[model samples]
Target: MRILKKILIVLVIIIAIPLIVALFVQKDYAVEREIVINQPNEEVFDYVKYLKNQDNYSKWAMMDPDMKKTYKGTDGTVGFVSAWDSDNEEVGKGEQEIVKIDEGRRIDFELRFYEPFESTEPAYMTTEEVSNDQTRVAWGFSGHMDYPMNLMFLFMDFEEMIGDDLQTGLENLKSELEE
Candidate 1:
């Protein structure tokens, strides 16, 4: 009986230590990736700012080729929303709404996921002229994860998980723009 009690206490300590440490760990996360596209900043920004144009470069949307999509408002303007439902676990279901647009510079989106996970985040794309015809485009997302949800990150490689997707999307964007 005494040995079992000691084992139980040790097990509790092991789990509690990480949970206690996680409480002090930062909960905010942001992932940013950039690529250079051989195109004018205005042209690149114009293409990206349009919600419907995601089909041309969004890696996630391509994950489920037949994913059902619905839209609201003007696609290239602020207040535009593009929601998708996919049967694929990886693709899941989500909606992205254009919340802000800085013509020739940036476009901000509010991303809300409902299936496979429930969360919301802010995503954006920015374009900067690198040369007379080359443009640098940056894509990223940021959000806060409260308490226990944040703790899961300690056991996961957050950047490694999403970095590939962002890089692929950026590459696709560059290809589409250059073509």
Candidate 2:
């Protein structure tokens, strides 16, 4: 039985090591990406303030074209919510609510994901004028994972993964706005 005891001890140590390490690891992650759009800042902000427009540029929104979507309240204002449901695991189910808007500057959204996994995250878009006819658009997403789950951050590059998607969406947005 000493062999069995030693094996159990080894397993416990293996698990405990990660748990201990996770105690010191960061529990939050944030990613931001930006692109230059050949549109006025006001025009870019006006378009981005409407969550409905995301379907035109968001990579995630285009993942499942058949996904069911529903909206509540007005499209471009605070308290507006856009919900989506899809059978695809990656797309899953989620709702994005416009929480705040800074006129022709920034728009903030609260994203709630319910299926496949559950988390409430914050996302935002900002528009700054580069010139009279050009705007710099920045998109950002941030979230947190508690304790042991945060350990996954060690193995996963959420920054690169999410940043790529954000960059793609921004590029798409640039193309849409410029066209």
Measured by lDDT, the strongest candidate is: 2
> Mind sharing the TM-score for model 2?
0.98
Tell me the TM-score of each prediction against the true structure. 0.93, 0.98
Candidate 1 wrong stretches, greater than 4 Å: none
lDDT of each: 0.90, 0.96
Among these predictions, the greatest TM-score belongs to 2
User: What would the per-residue lDDT of candidate 2 be over residues 6-93, giving only the tens digit for each residue?
Assistant: 9999999998999999999999999999998988898898899999999999999999999999999999999999999999999999
Q: Mind giving the per-residue lDDT tens digits that candidate 1 earns over 1-179?
A: 99999999999999998889889987988889999999888888888988888898989988988999999999899899999999999989999999998889989999999999999999999999999899999999887888867887878777767777999999998898887
* Candidate 2: residue pairs that collide: none
Q: Which pairs clash (backbone N, Cα, C closer than 3 Å) in model 1?
A: none
